[model samples]
Target: MNEHILLVNPWIYDFTAYDLWMKPLGLLYLASHLKNSGYKVTLLDCMDRHYPFMPLPDHPGPKRLKSVGCGSYYREKIPKPAQFLSIPRYWSRFGIPWDEVKKQLKEIEPPGWVFITGTMTYWYPGQVAFLNLVRQLWGKTQVIIGGWYPTLCSEHAHQWGFDRIIEGIDPLLVIKQLSSDFKELSTITGYKEFFSVKPAFDLYKKLDYTVVLTSIGCPFRCTYCASGRYFSEFWRRPWEQVLDEITYDYENYRIQDLAFYDDALLYRAEESFLPLLKALQKERLPLRFHLPNSIHARYVTREIAELMRECNFETLRISLEFSDVDSQKNTGNKVDNFIFEKAIQSFIQAGYAPEELEVYLLFGLPGLKAKDYELSIEYVTDLGLKPRLSLFSPLPGTPDFEKVIMHQIKDDPLFQNKIAYLYLSEQNELYEALQRKISKYTFFH
Candidate 1:
């Protein structure tokens, strides 16, 4: 008998949540692998916007959806977690209702095992709530929790009532563990290559848009980033394979909006990105691509910019963490003003207007002056590019993680909340003023 496995993308319990092309790519990847390995797999995405329960009383009237299948999730305002009571914000569980979750769980077959994956350590409250519900309905089943939350907060996550917790991104180890549950399981070979099974996007009730990852890992180890930690070695899929996935989505589901979830999407232009882009342009599929994760500013040459334009990239955000020379050097020398300017000009020449070009600016880094952040915003805006301010949240295992020293941050993951930190009201006058100053920018305001 095939072992029935249940995969879950748990609820996001936060003060605010939005669908920024966010999907459970990891869970889907796991689902595909399990199906290929001759196991039955099911996904319970609590955050599913297309959840069959229609006209939820909490959300009345027309659904508010936005560009490229990105929009709001069904939400219900819940009481703030005790730790977050100090911050004056309405907390909500972003996803289907509890009643609906119970109904869905009752409908599924008794699974041989359950796997839960989540991101963002601060959102563990949702995981706790989810596990409580699972325990109530399913009894004491074998539950495995993984993803960034468990990987970063293994010690903190132990109290959360999981049977096992996989610490890293190794699916092979997970499979080996699963073999113990089923006596008939045979030794699996070429498991790494077996991950090529098309992600189980078919599992969803409806398809709006899809996400693709042409590459994994990153070349640079920035001080405040955990991408390198998650993926030890940098690797890229063949362009043909990537193109096949995109074409599958386009042909079967009529999905036009595609997002790239790569850390170093444009690291080696000729080998990985360029060939893929050229193939996409040649195919001339009427599809729109988005890079929610910003691309390296220094890598954007004139030719690359043109290729992006031709390939129907609807949204482009350049990673320009800071314009200051010292700050640039401090953050792995990711981007310099000269290179940024060249990229901007090339983008302009390739037909991107000022409004279309968005530049990301990092705010609230330790030892960074408020004036430097202000100047960086001003510099980007002066160059006719939109400045997008991203607050810095220290991730565990990153180079800068050891340097954080504000109000028991190291002890609790909740302190990792970047936006909520502004509401703490304990910051210095200069830091508060800088927050107020950035608020004036129309993009944020």
Candidate 2:
């Protein structure tokens, strides 16, 4: 098919991958804006779980038990890059294979422009492979890359020879940047004009779940987080318009599960978030909401917790990164023990069982010890909630990035791998042992 623009969500190459209601909301939103602007846009999402030819007879895996848009991608084992060869975990390409991708691409005529989304910094190898293929098929096309990877590692992304590298989270910048090349966005001033329009999710033949952004940027400046770098200040989308988008997806698309990809969904409970929740509760919809992004523990008030339960917020992951006093204070003092326990109690009182909740406790942070992880895990499990052990990856622009930059992997984005960062070079076997021990301990409890 011919189109004015093409949006591609590249495959993910990692030690492991899972689909937890994943979709390229950024590209989809751009598709909506471009289409409304009188351009035909098509999406080539390699990670799409609902592909027509997926789940082949005796497939590698039969789309591993999708539960409300959460499941596994059709992954095949691919060779790991040389840098990651030290890490003994099996590397896989987590998406549709290239032959199927070729079949899809063969149908489409070369477009006027191609906008590709970049995710994790380490996942660029997947983009690299896909980029090579796109270049070979449609040489010299305008292929602009954007999203977290290009934003965080622009210098590295520039090496790949993209026509343009769009940085930052301002959706206005999308049209603004494209205008520089194609001479179209001079009439557009800000993102407000498109704020009311829903993302082009209707472009999909099937959408199991949808993701929404109620706010841009974050209010807190956590040292390990890059939110402040992505957006200089916190800005809330007009809650009414946001509510309209959510309900439109619910009613029109027949979508029942919605995920909020906001950096801070509850910065100030009295303002946008609370009102949005109240409006949603009033709708009496059976939609299940999820906050996979860590909700600030500081903002969880009794009323907020109660409203969350009322609105059917299914997945509640708290951002209680550190377990101790000083470390907790280091995390922008977002949540202290009293506040953390209070939030849990508030949710419990609001009809949530502790195990139904998940608490994120960071492991392998600079000063943390294995005992610290053990205590942190015990702390969450003791509260009757599950503990999510997140390995620390030093994202560029975060304060911690400097500490890791001194190492050799600084030249390679693969060094920033979240799961295998603890197992780099000479330290591999040691941390590998530690990972095994931690997994064993976790399974034990």
Candidate 3:
């Protein structure tokens, strides 16, 4: 019999969280990799909003899901962790109840190894809770944790005491390392083998949508982004592989709403992304594409805009991190005024409702006054685009984060939490006020 491997997506313990086209794609990819290697794989997503028996005994059921497949998670109020006690918000575990999780785990066979995924470096407490539960039931099961938390903050990760920690963003690299350590695991290497297999989306009985990454890394090294740190150089999948995955998603999973998790999908739009869009257009699979991750404004050409509309792009969000024209010109970090405005106009001309498009504006940066956000909100609203306040929280692996963040965040991932950052910096009030201001400004426009 094949050895069993359990893939667990831990709950998110935070002030607030919403499932905005989010899924544990990295872990699911590993599930496919291991299953291909002749291991039986199982997934236990604590954050699954569509968990079959959703409206269990006392629950009001999960929050309503939007037509676009993005909405609230099933959350329950929980005590704020000691580190977060200083912050005055009610914390919650944004997922299924722990009691329900325990009841479900009882039915599963004890696996040889357990794989858990980490996100938002600070959200490790949920992982700990799951691990503790597993320890009682499946004693000695080797638990390997991966994703940004371990890769970015290894020191902080080690404190969690998981059996193994696989660092880095590349799933193939993680599999390669595991194969070297334990020959029983998959022996794949590089992107070639990685893309050959589809992610184990079938592991779920149902899915709201599926996420696809046509490329890895990003070309632009924006000061606030960690893309450069992770990939160093940009790389996109072969045209054949991406096309295959998209078609497979539609055929196998009926995935109408496909979200692109690419950091920079439009970097080389014509060659890298356009061909895929054109192929999807030709196929006309009745798929609606989304970009939860913002795309580059500089690369949003009129033709690309038109093609995106033709391809049924729903969330056409672009990065307009700030409205400081002088800063943009001097830094060349973000797109210039001419390019940004042109992109918006192209989208409008492409038949996208001006209200449907979202323009992300970075807020909460150290030394960035609320007045800066006021100007950005005004600028974005004036253009008839919804202003999304992008939080300027520290990401450990990013160069900018290392330079300015305090030793506290460096020592403990808890301090890296977004809400924690706002309060610690004494700017929580400003962020809240800006949010209200953005909503008020964008309402009429």
Best by TM-score: 3
Give the candidates in order of lDDT, highest first. Answer: 3, 1, 2
lDDT of 3 by residue, 1-445 (tens): 5998889999998887888888998788778877877888899988888897654323333553377787677777888778778888889888878788888888888888888897777888888788788789988898888878888888877876789888887656687667854575554656767777788899888887999988878777676666556764677887778888889888998877999999888887767688887887898888888888888888888889999999999887888888888656533365976789999999999999987788888876555677778888888887777888877768876655765556787777778787788898788888888888876776655
| Model 2 residue 134 distance off true place after TM-score fit, in angstroms | 1.6
lDDT of 2 by residue, 1-445 (tens): 3247878998899988877878888788777767766777888888987777865322333343255667777778878778767676888888878788888987887777888887788888877777788788888678888887787888888898877788766676666777776454556665566465688888778888899988777777777877766664677887789888888898888988999998888886577889998998898888988887888777888899999999999888987876788888876777888889988889999999876787888766666665666677667766666777677887888776775643755677788887668776234554455457546655765
RMSD of 2: 2.8
Give the local distance difference test score of model 3: 0.80
TM-score-based ranking, best first? 3, 2, 1
RMSD values for the candidates in order, in angstroms, are 3.0, 2.8, 2.5
- Give the lowest summed-lDDT range of ten residues in model 1: 56-65
Q: What is candidate 1's CA lDDT for residue 313?
A: 93
lDDT of each: 0.79, 0.77, 0.80
| Candidate 3 root-mean-square deviation in Å | 2.5
lDDT at 87 for candidate 2?
74
lDDT of 1 by residue, 258-338 (tens): 899988898887897899888998999999999999998778888889999999898888989888998889879878999
In angstroms, the error of model 2 at 347 is 0.5
Question: Against the true structure, whose lDDT is highest?
Answer: 3
